[model samples]
Target chain A: MSNAGLDSAYDVAAVRQDFPILDKPLPGGMPLVYLDNGATVQKPRSVIEKLVECYENYNANVHRGIHSLGDQVTTELEAAREKVRALLGADEVEEILFTSGTTMSINLVANAWGRKFLRAGDELLLNEMEHHANLVPWQQIAHERGAKLRFIPLTADGRLDLTALDDVLTDRTKLVAVTAMSNVLGTINPIGEIAARAHARGALVLVDAAQSVPHGLVNVNDPRVDFFAFSGHKVYGPTGIGVLYGRRKILEAMDPFLCGGNMIRRVRKESSDFAELPSKFEAGTIPIAQAIGLGAAIDYVQGLGFEAIAAHEHQLTARAFDQLQQIPGLQIVGPGLAHRGSIVSFTVEGVHPHDMAELLDRKGVAVRAGHHCTMPLHEWLGVTATTRASFALYNTHAEIDALCEAIQYARQVFRRK
Target chain B: MSDDLYDDYILDHYESPYHRGHLEQPTIAHEDDNPLCGDRVHLELLVDEHDRIKEAWFDGHGCAISQASASILMKDIEGKTLDELRDFQAKQMLDLLKVRLTAARQKCGLLSFKVLKTMVYTLDERKGAMSPTQGGRG
Candidate 1:
C-alpha cells in the first residue's frame, strides 16, 4: 500500500456497503446522512460480528483460567496488541496499553509521567485548538504541580501559529502536547516538526491522534513522538477501548497510574513490585470484548488500506470544501492548514450554526453543530459555534452532492423568509 | 426528521426559535451557557396581576436540544406561576421527545428546565422584595 497508488485501489461504494447503519432511515422518513465522523464513526458489520462472536463463543474472563476458552481469549487479546503495535510501527507490543479512551490515556501520562517529572516553574505547552480532554488534563496537572502552562497560538486560518513557536518553546518548557488533526477546524498541525522542536528543547511531545488516526495513516516511528493517544470509537470500532502508544523506554521509567490486581507482580508486607511494561499501565479488568472488536476494526481498515482511506477522504474533502463554498454565506474556516483532515468546519453569515444544522437535517443531511469542544478556537474565530460536516471513507461523492443540495435548500428557506 | 439522533421539533426550534435575541426589560432573566457544546440561553419571564406568567420569552443560541427545550419551556410555563413552574421537570419533556438521548445529550435535553429553575428562584426573590399589593403595571 504505497501512498501514490492508493487512489486507484480504493472503492468508496464497496467500503460503504460494509457499514450496515448507513442504509437505515430516520424518524422523519428521510435517509440517515452521517457526516459527524470526527466525533465518532459507525462500526462496520465485520467489527460488530467479530465482537459478538467473541462473547457468544469464547465468553470467559481472560488471563486467569486454565480452561481452553481462557487460553484462546488471552491469545487473541495478545494478538490484538500485536496488531496495534504493527499499525503504529511501534518497536514492541509492550509499548501499547489499553485504556477507556484518549482522555484516560492522557490522564495516565499526566498523572504518571507529569507527576514524576514536572518541577516548580516548569512549563507545559498546549495548542489553542485542542479538544477539552487534552487541554483540561494538562491544565490540572500543571496547576497541581506548580508548573506554568502556555499555549501555542493558532494561525489566523486556525493552524498552529509557528511564527511564535520560537518564543513559546523556551528552556522552561517540559511538555508540548497538541492534536495531530484538530477535531473542530480540521487543521492538521505539523506534528513531526513540532515533535522535533520539542525534542530539541529537551521536552517530550504527546500527540492527540483521536481525529487523525481514523482518517489518515499515522506512524509513531517517523517523528519519534514520545507518546500518542487515540480512541477506538473514532476509528470505526466500539466505544470504551483506546490505544496509548508510548516509547518503551519512557513508559518503563514512568510510575504506574493505578495499583490494582493485574498491575502488581508481587506484594510484600510493606512493599509491592509492579508488573511489566504494558501490564503496569492497564489495571483491573480491561475492556476485553471491546479490544477484540478494535482488532477486527484494524483488520477492516487494513483490508481497505490506510493509504486508500486517506486518499479517498482527501478527495471527498476537496469536493465537500468546493461544494459547501458554493452555498451563499457559507464561509469555510481554517482552509489549508497543513494538509487538513476530513473534518471541515464553517459558519454561515446571518444563519446560526444551529439553524443551518436544522435546515440540513430536514433534507436528510447530518452535520455537527456548536463549538465542537473547541471553545477557544471558536472564540478566536469570533463566533460562538459553527456547523461541521466531516467525511469518512464510506462516504461517497453522491452524499456530498446530497449535502450540497440540502444546504442550497436551507439557504432558500432562510432567504424566502 | 430522519432517524438520525436529531429530533425534528428540536431542529425546528433551533432553526426558528420563537423569540430569539435580546429582550428589553426582561422581568426575570436567567442566562446559561454549556461550555462543552457552546450552547447559550437567556430566559425572560413576565408575570401578570394574578402572579401567573403573563408572557414568557427566551433569547439565545445553542444546539437543537437547547433551543427546542427553550421553545418547549416557553409553551409549558406561559400561564404558570413561579411556584407552579418550580414543579416543572425534564422527564415529562424527555417523554414528549420520544427519543433516547445519550448521557451527554440527556444533560442538553434538560437544560431548559435547569434555566427555569434558576430563573424562578431569582424571580421569587424579586417578588419577595415587592409588596403583595404592588402587583399592577408601574
Candidate 2:
C-alpha cells in the first residue's frame, strides 16, 4: 500500500464515480466544485449503502441483546471497531472507543484524565494553530486545576516554531495536545517529533487527528502518540460517530467521563462498578449504524490506498498553489505545498472572506470562510478571516482550475466597486 | 457584475465606511463580536438634552455587507431621538442593504443593527426609560 506504484496509479475520475455527490449541479445549473473537505467530506455510495443495510436489516441495540438482529449488530459494531483499530495501526481492538465526534473524544481525555491527574502549577502545552475544540478543552482543565496553559508559537510561514519546544516542555508539563494538521493554515505538524519531545520529559501526548487521519496515514502505535482522536465525518464517513484511541494502561488508570448504562459492569445499592477498557468510556448506546458506516469508509479509503490518496491530493494542492499564487492580492496563509496538507487558506486584499466565498459559491465553487474555528491563529496572523479551499481524493485538476477562475472573478467583482 | 448581494452601494460603504471612529464621552456605548467569524462592532451614540441622537459612530471590521450596513445605519440614526433609534427594526436595515442573503449571511448583514438595538435596550434598562411598545422593536 505504501509502494510508489500506488502513487502513480491514482485515477481521480474513477475515484469520483464512487462519490455520487460529485455529479450534482448547483442552484444555477453549474457543476458543483466541492472543495470544503476540511469541514466534512461527501460520502461514497458504498458507505451510504452500508448505512442503509444496517438500518434496513439488522437495526438493533448492541452488546446486551441475545436476539438474532442484536447479535448481528453487535458483531458488526465490534468489526467496525477492529477496522478502526487496523486503520490506526493499533495492537488491540479494545483501544478504540467510539464517541460522538472529535470534540467528545478530547473532552473525555480532558475530564477523565486531566481532572484526575493534573494538579496546581502543572503546565499543559498546546500550539497556537489548534482548533477551538483542542484549545478550549485544555483551557478549561487548566483553569479548573490552576495549571498554566503554554503555547508553541507559529513561525512567520505558519509553522510551529519547534525551536521553542525545549523551553515549552518542562518537567512540570503534564500533557501536550496538538493537531496533526492545522484546519486553517494547512501546515502539518510533526506529531511524532513533538510526541517524542513530550515523552522525554515524562509528558503524555494527545494528537487531534481530525484533519490528518482523513487525508494521510496515522499510526497510534508510533510510540509518540499516547492518545489520538478523529471524527468520522471528516474522513468520508457518517457523522455522529468518532474514535478515541488510548493506550490500554492509561485508559485502565483513568476515571470514566460518562457514567451510564452500557458503561457500567455492576450496580449496588450505593456503589457501582464500571466496564472495562473501551466500554468504560462509552456511556450510552453507541452510534451503531454510524460506526458501521465508518467501517465502510475506512474500507473505501484503504482500498484506494493512502499512498495514492496522498499523491493525488499533493498534485491537486501543488497545482492550486501555482495557479492561486498568480492571482494578484491573493496571499496564501500557510506554508508551501511541501509542508501543507490538502487545504489552502488565503486572503484576497481589499476583499472580505464572506464576499469572496459568496461570489465563489455563485460560480459553483464550494469553499469555507471565516476563522475556521481558529480565532487565535487568525488573530496571530493579523487577519479577521480567510477563505479556504480544501481538497479531497474525489476532486480533480479541472475543479482546481475552476476554483482559480472563480477567485479571479471575485476579485473583478470587488474591483468594480 | 451586479449580483443581488453585493451592489455598488454596499461595496462603496465597505470600501469607505462613514462615521467609523470612536466618540469621546458618549451617552451610550457598547461593543459585541461575532466569535464565529471574528466580526466585531463597537458603537457609540451622543445624545443631547432633547433625547435626540446628536451623533452616532461605529468602529469594527467585518465583511462588506456588515460594514456597508453599519455605514447606512450611521446615516439613518443621526439626529434621531432615542425612541426613534429603539423603534428601528432589523428589517429596515435589510431593506436598506437591498440584498437577499442566505440565512448565515443574514446574520452578518444585520449584526450592526442588532448591536445598536442592544445598546439602546441597555440604555433603556439602565434609565428605567421607554415603555414596552417602544423598546420592543426587533
Candidate 3:
C-alpha cells in the first residue's frame, strides 16, 4: 500500500477514511470503485459537515442585511473568497469572483470581456481539446461580433502542437483561451508557455482550470495569465459554486457579466453604475452555503498538500497505464504516463464505449463513456467516443486493479458475441 | 446475468444488422441523431401501390443496444402497412429489446422507432393520409 519514493507521510488509507462515500457499497454488495473524478469528485465529511453547519446556523442573505445572521453569513462568504484567493495563489482577494461553476465562469469572461474588447475581423484562439463550456461561449461571441475563432491543433500524441504558434498568435488574435489540463485526454498543457507566447502577441490568456486546479498547484498571478476559472464540485467541494480569477486591472476595466442587485452600485431606471472589484461581477444572492463548503474543501485539500496528492496520483496513473497497456486491444488515449495526469481515456477494439461503461458499472467500477464533452477532440482522434477512468486523491491501486479486471471482463463478454 | 442489457441476442443483431441499407428509391425516409451519445439512425420505407410497405431498411451507427433495436425494428415492420407502422408505439420497441434500460439508454434503444415514426408522420402530413388521432402513436 505504500507508494515508494512518494511522500510516505501522505497515507491514502487515512485520506480514504475522510471520505464517507468511499465506504458505501454499490448494488450486488460490491465495493464502489469510483474512477470518475474528472466529472466530479466525491465530497469528504468535512465539506458536508461545514455545509450543514452553515445552513443550520447562519442561513441568511449575504452583504445586504445588517443583522447578526447576515453579518455571520457575509463574513463566512468573504472568508471563502479569501480561501479561493489563497488556493489560486492570487495576488489580491478582489481578483476572485464567485459564480455558479466553470461553465458560467467562462461565459462571464466571454460576455463581459470578449464582447467589450474583441472587434470584427479579430480572432479568438482556442484549443481543439477544450470542453464545450470553453468552446460554446466563444463560438457565440464570434457569431455576434463577426469575429474569427481559431484552434491550436492537437499533435498526433494529443499534446497541443505549438509549432504553429508563431502563425496562430497573430496581432489580430485578441484572446487565447485554453484548458490547463484536458478533462478527457489528461494532457497537462504548458499553460505558462502558452500564456507567455500569447502575451508576447499582446493577447490575453484565459485558463480553464476545471481539471487542473483540483489535481495540482496553480498560481494565477503568473503575469502571463489574465483570467483563470475552476469549479468547486470537481475539487471535492459542494456543487453550485465556482471561482473566476481575473487580473485586478483588467477586471476593474471590464463591464459586469450580470446586471442586478449586489453587482450594481447605483441604478436609476436606464442608467446604472456597477460595483467595484469582485462584487461588480457577483450578481444577486450567490451560493452561500456552497461557497462556505468550498472553503472547507480548500482547507481539506491544503491540509493534504499538493505535493503528496500529485505524487500519489502520478503513481496511480503510471500503474493504470502499465496495466491497461497489457490488455490485448485496449488503446490508451492521450500522452504517455510522464506527461499525463490521473485521467485515463481509452477504447477497447470491437467494444462500444457505452457497453464497456455499462459492464464496468455492473462490476461496481464507475467510469465515464462517450464524447466527454470533447466531440471535436474525439473526431480529431478518429474516435466517436472513449471510455474514461479518471482518478482522485481518495482512489487506491486496488481500485485501479478492479477497473482493469472489469475492462478485461467487458472485452471478454463483447468478444463472446 | 452480467448486465443483461447487453444480451447475446442483442449483440448478434448489432454485429450483423438486418435490412441495414438505403433503398434505391424510397417513398419515405427520415434520419435522426441522439446528440448526447452520437447515435444516429436513418429509416427508409418503400411503399407499394396498395399503401403497404414493400421494403424497409435502416442505416446508422450507435451502441449495441441502439443498433440491435434498429435491426429488430427493421424485421418488425418489413411487410406491415403504413397504418400499422403509424400506430406503433415506443413500448412495443422496448418490448422487442427485452431488457430494461436506464432513462438515458432508453433514448438509445428507441432512436430507430422515433426515426420511423417521424418518417410515417411526415408522410401523413404531406399526403393528408391519417387524422391527428390516427397518427398520434410514437
Best by DockQ: 2
Cα displacement (angstroms), candidate 2, residue A272, comes to 1.2
Instruction: State residue A304's C-alpha deviation in candidate 3, in Å.
Output: 0.7
Candidate 2 vs candidate 3: the DockQ winner is 2
> DockQ, in order, for the candidates?
0.28, 0.74, 0.60
RMSD values for the candidates in order, in angstroms, are: 5.4, 3.8, 3.0
Candidate 2 lDDT, A270-367, residue by residue in tens: 99999997899999898999999999999999999988888888888988999999999899998977789999999998888988998999999999
lDDT for each residue of candidate 3 in A149-229, tens digit (9 for 90 to 100) = 998878889999999787778999999999999999999998888989899889999999999988874788764599999
Query: Which of the predicted structures, 1 or 3, would earn the higher lDDT when compared with the native?
Result: 3
Interface RMSD of each: 3.8, 0.9, 1.0
Worst 10 residues of 2 chain A by lDDT: A1-10
Docking class of 1: acceptable
Tell me the TM-score of each prediction against the true structure: 0.84, 0.94, 0.95
Which candidate, 1 or 3, has the higher TM-score? 3
| Comparison by lDDT, 1 against 2, better one | 2
Cα RMSD, model 1: 5.4
Model 3 misplaced stretches (Cα beyond 4 Å): A1-9, B1-3, B129-138
